[model samples]
Target: MSEPYEYWLLDLDGTLVDVEWDYVRDVFDTVGDRLDRPFTDAEAETLWHGLTGSRNRQLDAWNVDPERFWTTFHDVEDPQTRAESTYLYDDAAFVAGLDEPVGLVTHCQSFLTEPILDHLDIRDWFDAVCCCTDETGWKPDPEPVEGVITDLDVETTEGTGVLAGDGACDVGAAWNAGLDAIHVDRHGPHQRGHCVRGDYRVDSFDELDLP
Candidate 1:
């Protein structure tokens, strides 16, 4: 028998689309310059790795005003510039078109997320789209996922839903929220080692044996 999942909660960046990190690096570097401190390539790499979390500590350490920095960056950043560079993965459409209710849970800002979805022409596919810009907690906290499920008017129960993404936080969020997890390892390295615990691991959506 197939697993009884009524919904599929998915991550946005790195899962649905591979955003151009080069443009992202430019944005971060621009923010650093606005704060009167230029971020080195190494610093930019580290920041890129922690895109899902808060950077208040780093801002404080650099004596930069967090609010001003983000406000200025967002105000100056053009959504189209970034959205034009982002492309959906080969299986993104197929997965999004699945019969089950689909929802998005991402730490990406709404201003960016909304336009990116529109650009990809998949905005209407999701039953719910939760962005961290609204203050909904990011993955590993379960609030964003829970919020999306609630918005979709679905009950959260064991075997009722699955969370799929390309990172550990996606799996952790599913575990924390009592949902099954599928880790999409698009890279070859993750296929060998068992780093993050997930119910299923696949290189692409084609390999995902959804119930």
Candidate 2:
């Protein structure tokens, strides 16, 4: 960004860390088995990365019950196995050096997110962490972002803040909350199927043009 931001909020899953393909496949397989349908590799990738756009929309198109699929996914995933497979993106280490306050706003639930943070020894990096639940109203709704900023006690309205993430919902959440957004395009547009607009867009954290 050309201007300075007072604080930062970031998405956790695809933005900062990603589980290995083997783990990704295993989780999807379990979900598929429970749902009584098979998911091809392409389908799994699209859902896992939310490459096409809204995950619920994708699930709806597949005739899968969004609530049921999520319940099964969470139940099938082993926290320890997920932590073991998860690896932090090298570029994401940039967050550790940020002088401003940083918080996490992720759709990855707490049970899974906690272990990943603990395993990476990065739990202390964020002043606050908001794991979106049904009550928090998921991203694209400003509620969860509002919750995190409240937790961080960061200046609202007057302070410049930005949320960076690998998904369109992250950008939506930022914009909805009246904050700037950084679209971390981990997957190229070709793979993501469409580009997500943001105040700033970069392929890696190292590419952020912040002051």
Candidate 3:
């Protein structure tokens, strides 16, 4: 048998939570409404595929600050309402089932991550949580992944760490960080053919057989 990984770096958002697609659609619609140029579903798909850049670019295009956009989104009152709009996936329980050290490395901001975890009551399951907003760079950049690997004190040369995520950026980040990558395809279609490759591809956490 292959040696078990010493550390497991997991992704949030689509990987662990079933972020209500309607909520995302609503956010995009809100942005479109604010900009007076509503997007078609096709345009929305393109924007979502380019989220890491499109978000900032959209903010720039609108002459709005990205920070302001996020702040306003999170400031929405009615925690129960927000919770109702989002949901934790059944696979999230798999994290709690893992026996090895597990850390979360996500592109989401702490403000958003904290609430999601709190709602699921799975905050304590992670040994570390690294948010891109807390770092100088985001995923596909490796720095954030490196930060989590460093924080967990895992030896990179040992090849005993795996980064699991659903985006090309996540695979790229794992490759750049020199860790094994596991691609989770939670969304309809994954655009991983052009970007970084993964060591394994799984549809859900229940399928993960580490090592």
Candidate 4:
């Protein structure tokens, strides 16, 4: 954008920070063992990174029990450990400097997200943190983002707002909510297996030329 947004919404994991491969593999290993179905590395990557686009859709295709898997995932996930494993991207530092109202609208639940934000010491960067859930709906649904918008208390006219993230779901949510989307492509096309279209696409926040 030529100018800064009136208000901004951001995704958490993948967009700001990500857990290590060892952690990802470890989590899946535990979940798979419990499910009695080990996941291949490709499957793990696809699910973890949303490379296939929608994790729920992928799980459905594989006949995985969504409720059971998520429940197990929640049970096995260690908030402190995941938070300790998370690291902020170098380019993502600019978000802390943003002058306008900023909100976090993410699929990361509060149990995990709170620890991660505290771990990174970036909790103060957001005016509102809307952790997506059954009630609020996930990204690409626009409901959670709208909840964050309500929390930020910003009036938006067309083209004056934006949401940035590292997923197609983020783009969908942005457009669906009538805001501009900034697609931060952390994983290259070859790795992700496809491109995520958006009003703006970048590999790094350094490319935004924020001032």
Candidate 5:
């Protein structure tokens, strides 16, 4: 028998909103510039995505201080203003409008997350908004997800809820929290196929056949 989905947990970037990485890329460039060794656009793109874990290796090789580098990067990114650059998907709005109780579970910090939710006028749509902080941690770890589940007065029992996001960590977090996983393949099959091996897959929120 299948588990009943009593609640829905949603991811922000790439799942509900299309995040243009230009700003993020700029942050990467700024980091390089500050290091007095600038990176090419291509290099910035590679480091931004870090497909081969090369970013860390390069940082290590450069002897870049992780704390200093990331602090500078985050300062430049200014997710508060950057949130304005992202646009919401119609299907995401549809999902958010659903009558079911919904919780937002994201790796994004509350600084960015809160502004984005308010800008999109979906702040009140969620029963809970669980965001990562300096101490709260992020996805692929179950604490954030578990926090939202607790806020909703729901247990992290199997089939009790669903986690929908655009990355593998989302699914892994769902598994860790004992919730069903739904992978939103916004990048289509080729680019993101390997990242998703969840209970359900959908190219768009409209295609999601949730109950």
Candidate 6:
């Protein structure tokens, strides 16, 4: 029988939002241009992954504030240019189709989260959004995952709730917080040996048929 669930915890990037890495590439290029050390495409890709892993760490390394970094990144003067440059996943519209209450759990910082949700006009679909900030710790640590469950007031067990996301860390976080998991493989590759194993796997939300 399918496991029953009362709440759904969703990841934002790669899961709900299809962020164009070009925006990140452009940012890195701009930073490199200002620093006068241009990065190759390969190097930029490495930097992008590194940044994703080390967002909180970078704040401490650079001795700069997290909020400040986000403010600068999202402050493009032309609104249309920013909207044109950013993107939400084509399947994001399906989030509203969920029958149960859904909460957002993302490693993305608040400044980026709010604007992207506002841009897509889907902020209301989420019952709550837990973002990484100076106060909130990153995922795979269980703090943020626990926060989401607490806010949602969902039972945390094998059949009460499921955390769905696109990365191994998402699975780790869900397991750590005592919830079942659904792993979404947005990209083609699946790192089978990693910490992220799932109760169910799907390419898109349309394929997700949670009980």
Q: Who wins the TM-score comparison? A: 4
lDDT of 5 by residue, 12-57 (tens): 8778886567776677777777867676765565444432233446
True lDDT of residue 142, candidate 4: 88
Model 3 clash pairs? none
Instruction: Quote each prediction's TM-score.
Output: 0.80, 0.96, 0.79, 0.97, 0.82, 0.76
Off by over 4 Å in 1: 1-4, 40-42, 49-72, 186-194, 209-211
- The digit string of per-residue lDDT tens for model 2 on 27-92 reads 899899989998999999999999988888999999999999988988999998999999999998
Candidate 4, residue 20: Cα displacement in angstroms equals: 1.0
lDDT of 3: 0.71
Q: What local lDDT score does residue 48 receive in model 2, on the 0 to 100 scale? A: 94
- Candidate 3 has a TM-score of 0.79
Candidate 6's residue-wise lDDT over 75-98, tens digit each? 532344444566777666767877
Which stretches of model 6 miss by more than 4 angstroms?
Answer: 35-37, 46-84, 190-196, 209-211
Give the Cα lDDT of each candidate: 0.77, 0.91, 0.71, 0.91, 0.73, 0.69
Q: Per-residue lDDT tens digits of candidate 3, residues 89-193? A: 887677787787888988766766777788878888898888886444788788888888778887778478888887777888888888888887764343322
User: What RMSD, rounded to one decimal, does every model reach?
Assistant: 3.6, 1.3, 3.6, 1.0, 3.3, 4.4
Which residue pairs in candidate 6 have backbone atoms (N, alpha carbon, C) closer than 3 angstroms, thus clashing?
none
* Clash-forming residue pairs, model 5: none
Candidate 1 vs 4: which has more TM-score: 4
lDDT score of residue 28 within candidate 6: 62
The candidates, ranked best first by TM-score, are 4, 2, 5, 1, 3, 6
Q: Give me the overall lDDT of model 6.
A: 0.69
lDDT of 1 at 120: 87
